[model samples]
Target chain A: MSAADTILFVAAWLGLALLVAAFLLTVWRVVRGPTLPDRVVALDMLVGIVIGFIALIAIRTGFTLYIDIAIALGLVGFLATVAFARFILASKGRQGAGVYSAGAPLQDTAPAPDATHVAARGARGKSAAKSAKVAARTSGKTSAKKSPKSLPASPAVAELASVPAASPAIAPGKAAEEKPSAKSIGKPANKSASKTVSKSTSKTRSKSAEKTAGKAVTKPGKPAKGE
Target chain B: MDVVFAIFTAILILGGAAFALVAAIGLNRFPDVYSRMHAASKAGTVGSGLLLLAVGVHSGELSVLARALAGFFFFVLTAPVSAHLLAIAALKAGYSMSDKTVTNEME
Candidate 1:
């Protein structure tokens, strides 16, 4: 082979090796992450590494389509990160008790809203508590009153209320009540809440729940009649 | 001209690969998520940008160059934003930084 061809060949092999190593490191982070958000962040980095690999492949093979794939991967990766962040935020206390704490037995009651509220408030002070409370108020109204400031803790209460039960419709009403609060929280919160609302509403399959979720999603940033 | 271009491409690709390898090593060795993120975002973006530039140079086509440029810019823009968001989420979620990390910024 010519010198140029030889150089190209060597470069391709080197690039592949580097990318593979990077991928492995990212996977290690995913496996070793102490917290859920750490895992999410690692997963996001993995997506980026994969995009880099795709770009390298495109370079070696002269396929432009792979570049387009890299772009799509970036966009989708961003969306996934946002979704995961929202999930982490919404499901605050539940995850801390079940996943992060080492050797702790998973208790059904472990993710209590009060625990999460205290944790959120302790960790981030008033701002986080305010955000968490806003999130809670958007998810349900009954729990919203217990601690107007304890937003992060409200998810456990909401989840408990949402357990597939005879009164599935009741949970939706609570969720619907918080729709206006979601709109006020801004776009990311609105999108994440709508996504969660849709999922819960679909699972319950209550017509009123579906209607409420639909209306909340459509008229985002606008307070509905339920108030 | 061809020989010069080939030499430049080779150098760029090799250097980019080396940077990527270093980044991986750092990511694995860092004690905390914040530090790991720092290593990954900075080195990874630079490595990928260099590799894309190499590709653009090797192809010598305007379309390929343009695509590479776009990819480079996209990486530059997105990598920092993701890193920042991840850091914020981790902090909000109460993931403490490593004890060895001496910084008063977050406090």
Candidate 2:
């Protein structure tokens, strides 16, 4: 081979080795990342390393088209990162707390009460109430500080409180009968309350009651009833 | 002239590969995500830019050079923005830096 050809061949091999190493390291980060955002960041870096590899391949093969692939990857990679970020943000908003820590347990991230959880809680009577009580106790200090006006104004909490505390003794059949009408009444209130909460407390807790409400909402399902 | 160009291309390509290897090492060794991102974004961009420049030099075609230049510019522009966004997302997700990291931002 000519001198230039030899140089080009050696450079290509070196570049390939470096790119492969980068790719593997990025993959390790993606696998080992403690948090969702960390994984996202690692994924983003992986895309970048892929782009670099594409550029190297284009140079080695003298295929101009591959450069276009690198350009498209750059654009699409940015969009992917943004989309992942949005997903995490939406989940955070739904969970109502900073439960995104990598080391934290999954149970800690119990999401806020949505319609599904509300329905489920209604279906499971005594167990749900016990869980709610547990949640209420854990979150009691925060709830105690919240003003009654704010407390009742939040439709989800209001609907929850409006449920006759005595209903725990009532059979599920009768409780179901009463819950439908109450949920219907709560539907409009739920929307306005969610909007206000989302607006006011986009980041940190505006009031601890919201966190308590989230816990209470999710609590009713599977808390080892005898415990 | 051809020999000189070939020598220059060899140096650029080799140097770029070395920088990339360093970047990969830094990514693996860095103590925190923020610092790893710092290494990946800055060194990775420069390394890629140099490799593109080498490719442009080796090709000597106006079209290929133009394409390489475009690729370099696009890489430079987007790499930093993505890094910054990732850092912001990490912070928003409540990721604390290593305790050894000396910054008063949290305080």
Candidate 3:
């Protein structure tokens, strides 16, 4: 082989090794990433690594067409990242016991089972994330109360709304009075209430029960009319 | 002439690969998504762009080099825009910063 051929060959092999290393590292991040954005970032890096692979292959094979493929992949990757960002934005209000909820924090919001999973995860430093966590806590604190009035646009919040309304501890006499109104909320409301019941049963059973009960008896009697 | 082109392509390939490796290391080690984006968008783009140039140079044809250069520039332009949008979405969605974070002017 010519001197130029030898040098090019060596560089291509070395570059391939580096690119492969990068691919594995990025994949590890994707697997271990705690939040949606982390995974998105990793996936974006993965795309870049693949583009590198394409370049290496193009150089090794002497086919310039592969360059076109790399460009197409870049376009697609950018679009995918944008779409994922939009998805993250849309999922903002889905806070109750959701594993994917961004800014849920490692210590407080995430339950014990997912603790290890979330512990090592990092969100970019911003007060906005802190504010989100605070907002979630505050919302969750009043979720039981707000769900009734708002009827909670999402079923997850609706489940939270039903927690207290479904409790038997509420005076049967009052519940009887509210039963007719509760029935009007219909099957979807009942389904969500059952979900909260099951969820609460697994977690802080007595507290969520009583907390909702104390609040449910008041004005919530109308909106939280549980099935 | 062939030797000159080969030497240049080898250098581009080596530099590009090194940058890509650095980006991967940063991505794995960075404390948060935004920092990781910093690594991926800037270093990763340069790495990939360099590799694209390598392909263009290896072909030793002006037309092929032009196509590779165009792709390289495209990477340079789009990476930042996508990263910015993603960062905003993450912030707006309330993705928290790491505990080690010392300052947040945007807060």
lDDT tens digits, residue span A1-227, model 2: 87877777787788778778878887877766644566777777777777767777877888877867877887898889878767765554332243211111212333323322333343235655445443433333233233232232234433444442322222323322332232222112222233432232222221223344456665553443434
Give the C-alpha lDDT of model 2.
Answer: 0.59
**Top-lDDT candidate index:** 3
- In order, candidate lDDTs are 0.59, 0.59, 0.67
What does candidate 1 score on TM? Answer: 0.59
The iRMS of model 2 comes to: 6.6
The positional error of residue B68 in candidate 1, measured at the CA in angstroms, is 1.0
- State the displacement of the C-alpha of residue A140, model 3, in Å, after optimal TM-score superposition: 25
Best by DockQ: 1
lDDT of 1 by residue, A1-227 (tens): 87877777787787788778878877876776655666776777677667667767876897866777777787798778777777766653233322111111111212335433433343244544544533342334443565555545556545644443422222434333453343232112122233453333322223223333233233322222333
Q: Write the per-residue lDDT of candidate 2 for residues B1-107, one digit (tens) a residue.
A: 77677778778777776677677677778877788888778887787777777777778888888987898898789888888877776555445465567654654
User: Which residue pairs show collisions in model 3?
Assistant: A124-B97, A125-B97
After the best TM-score superposition of candidate 3, give how far the Cα of residue B28 lies from its true spot, in angstroms: 0.9
lDDT of 3 at B9: 97
lDDT of 1: 0.59
Candidate 1 chain A: worst 10 consecutive residues by lDDT?
Answer: A100-109
Docking class of 2: incorrect
DockQ winner, 1 or 3: 1
